[model samples]
Target: MSDASPVHFIAHFTVTDGDGYHNYEKRFFPVLKPYGAKFITFDDNVTVLEGEREAGRTVIIQFPSEKVLMEWWNSPEYRELAAIRHQATTTFSVSVIHAIPQR
Candidate 1:
């Protein structure tokens, strides 16, 4: 993995039911840890500097590699938890970004 950069999981969520979403949030961390995922940030105060502004909460998570990211995303544990998120909120977008190498 030395030759490759880390991968980031970026998600934008529009929560419909606070209680349901909260339940999903509570269980998120524990499930993610086993897969070597690190929570970067969850931002509710998002600003659009360019074309259009999107509404929702933004969350960023990092994985050691894209392979790890895919493993975590496809794992049974995460899939179960993801069902909770699916019911709780409307996901605007979920993307995997490869970090740029540092100078």
Candidate 2:
């Protein structure tokens, strides 16, 4: 994909500490504001149609491009917030998906 290709941040996890995770959720949007991201969806009930993947809370966030997404992801602000998530949740996987390029 090209540098301008959009990217999606997908995370699947189970919250182990409600209070701490909640704290992360509440402050997430504000921290994301300056990053030019779109909070697409947050679903606690995920239907895994196939595979051995277990269902859990799923979060999807879209960023205009991979560069922007990386900047936000590697930022100190997000790192601090992610520390809370790491401590409060049993993370299954977090991935960055690139959008298909136009033909």
Report the number of the highest-TM-score candidate: 2
Backbone atom clashes (below 3 Å) for every candidate: 0, 0
lDDT of 1 by residue, 40-96 (tens): 998887877878646789999999888888888999998999999999999989998
Clashing pairs in 1: none
Quote each prediction's TM-score: 0.88, 0.91
Error of 2 at 70 (Å): 0.7
Report lDDT (CA) for all predictions: 0.87, 0.89
State in Å the error of residue 2, model 1. 6.5
**Cα-based lDDT at residue 59, candidate 2:** 89
Per-residue error for 101 in candidate 1, Å, reads 6.3
